[model samples]
Target: MENNNFLLKINNLKTYFYLDEGILKAVDGVSFKIEKEKVLGLVGESGCGKSVTAQSILRIVPPPGKVEGKILLHQKNGSAKKEPLDLAKLDPQGKKIRSIRGKEIAMIFQEPMTSFSPLHTIGNQIMEAILLHQNVNKQEARVLAIDMLDKVGMSNPHRRIDEYPHQLSGGMRQRGMIAMALSCNPSILIADEPTTALDVTVQAQILELMKDLQAKFGMSIIYITHNLGVIAEMSEEVAVMYLGRIVEYASVDDIFDSPLHPYTKALLKSIPKVGKKAKVRLDSIKGTVPLPLDLPPGCSFYARCGQAKEGICNKDTPPLLEAKEKHWVRCFLYT
Candidate 1:
């Protein structure tokens, strides 16, 4: 039985892609929970399974991808009892999962340009999402869609509504995507690098807008990003992933102030701080991420981890263990 405190719980999730070469474990044995109305940041470098984990939750992984384990969602049935639904067990194209997807859990993809259809007007797309889960008519859907656009800080929403994706600026397009994702009043929102392609100003604007919306709607969010600064600003909790696994999980304060895993420490050091002396070279973690098919036998991060032990890190995998209250780290150093 799952704890009633959590809105969504992922248990031992393993999403693998079967290519001709070999099986790619994109998300291997990942587990976590999102509390009601809280934001959880999933942070890592490229190819670290941050986006793949988010996609697995939505059942949107492309072909040859096999998703295993439980994704339990605490769903309210318009009654006092809230039943737990295992999203991984449901058919990907079935009505039950489809209905639950956009209605209960919505996702704003990394890039808005690729996500939106060029042929359709922004209003039409937003209205489509509203129509899919909402019982309102076309006119009502349009009204709600425009309202959402306005809420997301899009100016002249009435005029912008008729514009196509090509007509809007990158920031506006991203805000439009957020409007569509939240139109259904989803309980959980998976924002996968929502600010990746925007300018610094626009990125700040988008983050503030998301914070305001989260406060207003009281919806939980899973924020995926490589930027630790953004993670610190937006998320209450953080999970550091590497090679398809979460190496560290803790509150944002704990992650920044007291990172336990070697990978997490390396990532923090890579960031340039404001007080650093002039002309000083920024620190970087050495070694490239291992390819999915070429992962090591024991700890996948052993090759790249700076504090790896000779026998333990390379010979046996370390389980995720709690180092402090509510802080978890997967490293032999803690064990």
Candidate 2:
């Protein structure tokens, strides 16, 4: 049975890709729960599986990749009964998953241009999703799409809706992407590096728009980004990932004030302080990431961690343990 408190629960998810050389474990035994109507930030470096985990939830992982374990969506039935659906079991291309993908859980992909078709206008793409999910005709869907575009702060939405994606500026296109994702009023939104390509001014505006829309829409958000600054500003809870595993999970204040895991500490230290002296070199996390195919035994971060003990840290993989009230960390020191 699904709990009313959680919107989605991911349990020990493992997404692996079969390659000619070896199997690459992109997401290895990651687990977490998204609370209802809250923002959960997934932060990590590139190739740390933040994006793959989001794709796995929607069963959209690319070919040669296998998604295992449970992705339970706590959905309500017509009679007010609860039925937990394991999204991993649903056929990716089937009608059921397709209906649930955009209607219940929407995604704002990293690149709007790639996600949209250049041949069609933004209105067509947004209205297509609305027509597929909602009980609306083409004309009504177009109205709804334009309304959504306006809500996301698109200027001259009626005029812009007919314009092709290339005709719009980068920020306008990003807002259009948000409009497309939110057109159906999904319960959950997955934003994968939503502001990565925008300038600082535009990025702040987009962030504000997202935050405002999240409250108005009453949706839980899975915000995946490499920028800790953005995470601090937008998220209520924070999950720090490394090499496909969540090493630290805590409240935003806890993550910033007192990070427990060695990796999390190193990451926070690498950030340049606002008041620091000029010409001071920022501290960087030492050691390169281990190859996914040939991950070392025991703790994967053993080599990079400065506080690692030879035998203890390299002997066994540490489990994600709750060390404090509502604070979890995966490390030998905490274990």
Q: Which ten residues in a row have the lowest lDDT in candidate 2?
A: 273-282
Candidate 2, residue 211: how far the Cα is off, in Å:
0.3
lDDT (10s digit) by residue, model 1, range 26-89: 9999999998899999988888898889889999889899899999898845432566889999
| Tens-digit per-residue lDDT, 39-126, candidate 2 | 9999877778999999999999998999999998876342224767899998988888888888889999777887889999999999
lDDT of 2: 0.87
Q: Estimate the lDDT of model 1.
A: 0.88
Instruction: Give TM-scores for every candidate, taking all chains together and pairing residue i with residue i.
Output: 0.95, 0.94
Task: Tell me the spans in candidate 2 whose CA falls farther than 4 Å from its real position.
Answer: 1-4, 76-81, 272-283
Any runs in candidate 1 off by more than 4 Å, and if so which? 78-81, 272-283
